[model samples]
Target: MEFYGKGNLWNFVEEERRNMHFTRSLSFSTDQNVSEPHESPFVSPKASSASATSIPLSPMSPETPWKLSPMHASPSPSLLYHCLASLHRYEGNVFSIAISRDFIFTGSESSRIHTWKRPDCTEVGHIKASSPDVRAILAHGRILFTTHGDCKIRVWDVSVTEKFRPKKITTLPHRNPFFLFPKKNSHQHKDYISCLAYNDGEKLLYTGSWDKSVKVWNIFEKRCVDSFVAHEGHINAIVINQQDGCVFTCSSDGAVKIWRRVYGESSHILTMTLKFQLSPVNTLALSSSPSSCFLYSGSSDGLINFWDKEKTSGRFNHCGFLQGHHFAVLCLATIRELILSGSEDATIRVWRREEGHCFHSCLAVMDGHHGPVRCLAASLEIEGLLVYSASLDRTFKVWRVKLLTPEKAAMEELVVTNDQQTEIEECKMSPVLSPSWVEKKIQANHFQ
Candidate 1:
């Protein structure tokens, strides 16, 4: 298939991968294709982010825990800010980023997956995958899996050494492409692969695509074992819950559906559908605590709807929504009981969930990235929590969030308040908001 993605503008020289430049000034592509929704001008510079000279809002008074000081504003900048260790290494938009125990990997329009030494940001190596545009990257050990615009997924074996070289261990599409995958009249995803999720225990890899199909692949065998049509529109993201063996997928269709594995069978069955989203669902994430699990979905309309099990229908219920962004919510990352979401507003808002509460309070907003925040990764530092965020502005920022006082956060009493209101209305026959709030109380619940 011919590639038409925004990454296709660059044609890198594969043979020169080992000799790629390490400086941020390196030029790989001349095209700068950024979406307008991320560049909205509705926020004043002071109200949108943290300021160095601004006075603090009396520490927000412990009683008003999650109420951010800024009015559609985020928490104080001092609580969460950008790390000076940030680097603008990529020449184009950094689409996908992955984090491991000791290293970080990022893929972009350059087709080469760049590796850097962690704790101290330094370029170590670069591997040129065959595909010129790598859309998604997920790492499981020494093995690196990447999806691209060619409708193909490739696996690589590599090392973290200065002299490390990447060898192409496997390619998903064999010679008999259409034999295993039938022609669905071009409605299905015979196109670019957008996102990927790996089930370590099941040894299965799930790939979502622009063609709107979720195909399960056995990475060890380089063969697609199972295939299913997940959504009526293009599939954006896929995440699995290992505890219950459930798979959740969100799409441009403005719906988030739940699917479960069939016992003794290789396929899955659709269980329930969660709808009423005002915009196309862009991403979904599942966070599990010792007692319960929480499901979060982000949309183009800049709202996040969380789902939990309800006894009334025995299906996932739209508990409530969280609102701190004025643009599309692009990605979400969970750190313990706290949820950190990145958005086209070019900010990352941090929210905390108390043990017994279901509603979350906005704690701080990290406005370090220059462009629309596309992806996020988190790790532990001996002294603080490190959050790595990638953006369309061709730069990545590392943040240091001060959540050191876990005991203080627990002792503090929060009077959960609902100041904003949005409802799920009947599905309108509109253009899905073209893809493309909550002031609800937080309560402790589970989705078993």
Candidate 2:
């Protein structure tokens, strides 16, 4: 049977995959006609929400914890997403995005770290750094951390007064006047710092570097307390399971390793290794619940592999994978039950995991960026969810997403089907028209 609308097409496919227990499901369409780029006040889903699925939220804190207020569900059956604003600057491509409290931070090839306010996404101020090309940024509570191309990490104390100037607290590998010849191998990263994670309970910071090592820093001490080689290749991403102090790191070596602190010592020891695919893993995200926990790793092959945390063994077992993106999966962000992935294909796919099973469904595919999506940040809003994505195209966009219950989604689908039917019937009765030469050229370029 022919599908009338793209919405129905994806929905039918997803439903079939769900029933068949298939992992490699959606194949994103790349042959759509091209349109001129324009900023819309609202977010239009590239795919309809009728094909989407959402799960209930269990009160849990993600790696990047947000101070969220109680969410009041919308009564609407259809999904709602708004493009609150698009933030852009002339600086080089945005490499990282971080959300802390009410402020959003964007780091780029420039030394300045730009800041924007929530809701409106208005520019406040920026913090100038000592070096160019800020690669990674992590903000927690009032403390903010940024890594530069110099392979140095800087810490800042953020205060939101009239001006958004954050004070420079200290730099990692604290410079000592007495010890002029400090050992670089023991103190500073040998290569670019790629990612950062913070453990609030221990007040410690984790930094993963392209030098294939992971370092633990004591926030108060302003020094690296422990360091170890994490992977055989460049370390790409690092995430911490705050519930337990277990740290997870992925690398270009095509491996994901788990590390745990040695009892009361500051050092860490490898607990387990997860390497199923030969492709390089680029990013990771962790989801925790009272009943079970999950670990998601995005790799170079444009597939997301997830693992189920075993309660008795305290190890992650390979569960399954999510397939959709046409290019490498570059970054991942998790909020509650939602998993958002940015890819080299310049699109973001939203996925929701079923409550008690390993089942996952692609909720939506968002496309707007002209280049690879480099980084992503997300937080829960009172009425919906806020997602911030920074792209290599030198722009960052804020999206507010609202999901519907399964019952509401089913009802909404019927209405969408009726509307689609009328449109299809009208097109059938109308005479066919040829597109203009310019439109055809644009479409040709899109496919090329």
Best by lDDT: 2
Off by over 4 Å in 2: 1-78, 179-185, 406-448
**Candidate 1, 3-28: lDDT as tens digits:** 11222212212212223343332122
Could you tally the backbone clashes for each prediction?
Answer: 9, 0
Q: At residue 200, what lDDT does model 2 achieve?
A: 83
How high is the CA lDDT of each candidate model? 0.64, 0.71
Query: After aligning candidate 2 to the native by TM-score, how far in Å is the CA of 279 from where it should be?
Result: 0.6
Score residue 196 of candidate 1 by CA lDDT.
87
lDDT per residue, candidate 2, 1-448, as tens digits?
Answer: 0111213212422333234321222432231122324312111222222111222222322331111111112222335344555654445568898888878888887676777777567666667676767889999988789998878888888877665657888777788767768556457999889899999889999999988899999988787889999998889899998889899999888899999999889999998999988888889999887788899999877889999999998879999899987666889988877899998666777888888899997766665555568899888878678889977555678777768776865554443433333433453333122123223323434754
Candidate 2: 10-residue stretch with minimal lDDT:
64-73
Given candidate 2, what's the lDDT at residue 366? 62
Candidate 2 Cα deviation (angstroms), residue 441: 20
Number of backbone clashes in candidate 1: 9
